[model samples]
Target chain A: MASQTRQWLLTNPPVADIKLSGDDATFSLVTKELPPVGPNQALVKTLYLSNDPAQRTWIQKDQDPERLYLPPVQKDTPMKAFGICEVVQSEAENLKKGDLVLTEANWTEYSVQDAAALRPVQPDPEHGIKPTHFLGSLGFTGMTAYWGLVDVVRTTASDTVVVSGAAGATGSMVVQIAKHLVGCKRIIGIAGSDEKCRWVESLGADTCINYKSKSFKEDLIKATEGYVEVYYDNVGGEILDLMLTRMKRHGRIAACGAISNYNNGNEKQISNWNEVIFNRIEIRGLIVLDAMPKMGEIMETLSKGVKDGKIKMTEESETIVKSKFEDIPSTWMMLFQGGNQGKLITQLV
Target chain B: MASQTRQWLLTNPPVADIKLSGDDATFSLVTKELPPVGPNQALVKTLYLSNDPAQRTWIQKDQDPERLYLPPVQKDTPMKAFGICEVVQSEAENLKKGDLVLTEANWTEYSVQDAAALRPVQPDPEHGIKPTHFLGSLGFTGMTAYWGLVDVVRTTASDTVVVSGAAGATGSMVVQIAKHLVGCKRIIGIAGSDEKCRWVESLGADTCINYKSKSFKEDLIKATEGYVEVYYDNVGGEILDLMLTRMKRHGRIAACGAISNYNNGNEKQISNWNEVIFNRIEIRGLIVLDAMPKMGEIMETLSKGVKDGKIKMTEESETIVKSKFEDIPSTWMMLFQGGNQGKLITQLV
Candidate 1:
């Protein structure tokens, strides 16, 4: 049975002198017969997709050359992302037809992937969760928070944790995971606005400070009382420097992402590294892809937490004009402008 | 009998414009009658004093202007140091006269100190170690190596350990301890010359590289084979930069001391910190004074190792003339120039 699949492809790749604008970019949906699944592969139908800031990082032609986190996306290729899918056809042993799965599927209606890349999503009927929950809370973002706090940072109950980009998916998970699992004494969430700050506090943070406010540093210090032991940094730049000053002795900083400096061509350099010597701080940069082996452990912990009502998960939804998968480029552009929040996904059914 | 004691004092302090030379910069030996020991205090006759690079850092006016470590040496006060002392008189319950002890005794022939600051030395009859060993391998330097490797660096037996300043007192002990107790598979020692490299290899390093060689970086790469897992950094600056580039993922760097840039009025700044993020390295700065509480555990390990002949210990001795005590300023000046190896001491007997 031949099946038709539609994928959004980039055309007229941006060059060095070109600026990223609608006039210079195009998104096209190509309809083709679905390819046969290999011996250890499955055919998955896309359900919910994740639009992340990391995607914008790769879309820019002139991103920071010093970015050690993600590799630069090649020209004119299908963009990569995590999406919730249903296994429509399968040749693999573990996955059967109609099995809900999560995988690094392309920005397409249908994807045929190796069984190694696909994780079977066992639906939890008891938690009253949706398939979208697998794309947000029980997904890459949640796992990133778990590994960054537990494995990389080694945060303890006595620690005071401060997280940047606190309203976003990974940052939100970081705040909750640190508070609930690690039993962090104090959690100060730094977000762009007061509404996000309030939302972060709703997730059980001790305090939440608006980074957009003029008194962000003062507020952070007041909230943490000059005792920040673990800094889960998602947005770097001046905020990073500010947090470094307030770090206690033997503090651990997990440099998860530098979203503030990601779009800028030049990287921000820390001026006072002598403080690193004086305070004896340990700073580490991490990538979730590098943390893939611990996926099983992270899932077990997060699933239990979700079931016990310890980890509260939420998503922000935005309705955008949908075309035949050809409007993904425009949808992604809106995301970069902060037009969407939480998990940005387009409904295909 | 009341004893008459003489001690060297920094009589004139260095102001911003004042040169460290000439009559204004004076060291005076004052003959004074000893004061009576109070309860919980002991009068000790200083035997061997330990002169370290960190002492120079304490004298600088600009280094940590707030005096995070300790206040700058006051004019006309006895210089501070760690020394092996013989108890002349004791009013404390734990100590008695004729007992050899180790304490933070000043650079003097005789001084009074609290018994709480002193640890009674138990002579190990099997090893036949000297009293000076308490100031070197079995004392502060030895304990420094123990904590930095085990606790700070968290070295494992499978690690490939690299020690910078490997021929120095603490560095030598670090090499031996990592090789014997930690059971490191490969130990590479970096020293100043071929002779020092040979000395490090003799002390049980699998390989040793001369940092002074023109092709030192190439030699280091060839020697270690790009497999440095734990770097015990005693000398920072360019050597540190070199080590950072080759560090394996999750490598631990024990920033024990930066002897290379310690006395540079303008300290050298590290440029290639991107390697820190790229390799996901953890660099921890350490002070041996902070490791004092673990003295008992450290001694237990060292005593057993020394008794079993698993640890080889050596001390570098450079003796200054007794009259040169007045030239204390110049004597300390020589240390910044790397004029002495192992330990530099002034003889008064």
Candidate 2:
């Protein structure tokens, strides 16, 4: 029997606030017939979709095409999504039918993508890592934390690191790597809720501050003992400003993401450049693509770490909100409000 | 007859505003008998004193003593000053009487310092470098410009550069070095007045913006043609914010000084961290001492550049407000208000 495919297209991009009722005109759901796989192509059935803060920036309008590191999402196009998939049919020599893979299949039930775009995700059954773990702990999010902390900031065991968005996917891994793997002297986590703070502490953070609380500033000063040597910033805004105030001389900041300001047209004003100058801080914007060439070695090390119990990842057991394929838009919106914990993903059969 | 030494002490530190009338009690003048030079010490007569923006930071009442790269100024001690001097008495084999030197000699007519602290300033008469030029373009100020532009920022001829405080001592040298010596594609200067702008243009800046002008923002946007690859900032405040808006991806900034926000307790808030993140800008604070190990090679190159007419310095014929030894307080006050130009100094004979 011929296969049927379903896809969602961004009809109207969200400008101010993101809505996710499935009734909103933000996305249009449509059913269609699956096309045949051509030469060097594979028919991929989406399994697990990944949602990230960068999605907000990819939808921003009036961007300088030259400045944007990623291509902007266009209206009427299938919104881009990264996910784990199962190859249903293939006309390529490198991939065979029934092979598990990772690729950008968009918000689609089934996608006919070039075989070159898919990465084989054959997890060692002996190691007991789920295929979806390939999308979270062993994928781009894990690499983001690795390259940011180890390659970019070059954090040392003696350094005190402050991780903003500490409860989020990339930030949670950063906290663990800084504490358990890198042996940082102290790790402080800045998150939004009391529960998130507790989760961050469980990930081995020395202390976690709920930024939503009124006493966060006083608490941060007391927690870090008035000194911070490395700041792993994933949420850039006022919290980044506060971090700047207590940075030690020659402090290094790994500018990984700006999730806090991504949804508001990125107009958040930071008013602590004086501190950056006086403290001799170095804030380097991190684009994971720059570290892609070295990923094979990084992934090998990460896989070994998982087997050795050196890298303890929280995404496997906590906070992953499971949803149906039809709920992609709603699941994505949860990322903006921190409603989705761990890595936000939608599973499709 | 024994020689008497005169010096100025910070009897009452300036907390709010700096006044120089000698009656404000911020400084006290006293005369005392000169002590004999000890072994390895040289008794030097002060010539030309360098008034810098960093001096204002040294006297702050509440400073993290460990963070300060330099020792803070104490209430009863002589104010720290760098100047050209003539070694009158030398007990160390490295120095001799009447030899010209450059060293830190407080606000004093005579200073007995370790001979190792003084670097010989033997400019070949054929080079036509005046004795006072050592305090301006050949001393620490020149080294500041050299390390910041060439070593730290590593600017190339293909880059467009913007310099704030382009008419001042270190800044003017940076402008000349980027344009004339480094061969940058375009050099734009941001200064306080139209006259200073013209002076900066004459110093080889492709264009100059009078930051005090009402149309400064529009003028800056128009001048750069919507792109700036390097920013050599000396006056860090709103000007730094303006530069942030125009910086290109992977832009480099050499944070040399914050003269604009140095006085009045450095309260000027910077609101441009967002730009620093999106543009992938690297702002590095330049502490000249960190570059001291390379001084021999750098000083040699700068001296050769001056001799070969490759480094066209502007201080040869500019506003250098020279005063007597007792006028150090008043001369320093000129720096905050922009009352003096070129290099503000006290010529003590």
Local distance difference test, each candidate: 0.73, 0.80
CAPRI class assigned to model 1: incorrect
| Best-matching candidate per DockQ | 2
What docking grade does candidate 2 earn? acceptable
Backbone clash count for every predicted candidate, in the order shown: 0, 0
How does residue A297 of candidate 2 score in lDDT? 85
lDDT of 2 by residue, A1-349 (tens): 2378778887777765665545657778888887777899988888788888887766655555555667777887888888888888888999988899999978898889898999998776667677877777788988889898999889999999999988888888898889878999999999889988998898889999999899999999888776888999998877887787778888989888888776665353565555655667787887778788999988887788788877664443235556777877887788878785566667754
* Candidate 2 DockQ vs. native: 0.30
TM-score for each predicted model, relative to the true structure: 0.75, 0.84
Model 2: how far residue B300 lies from native, Å: 1.5
iRMS value of model 1?
4.1
How do the residues B227-291 of candidate 2 rate in per-residue lDDT, one tens digit apiece?
88899999887788778778888888988888766654536355545566666777787788877
- Can you write out model 1's per-residue Cα lDDT over A1-349, one digit (the tens) per residue? 3277877665543432223346565345567777888898888988767767666555456434344456655566677677778888899999899888888776888888898888877776667566777777787788888888889989889888999878777888888898888888888898887877888898878888988799977888788675688999887667776786778877888977766654554343454444555567788877677778888888889999988889875444222224346556556554445454445565554
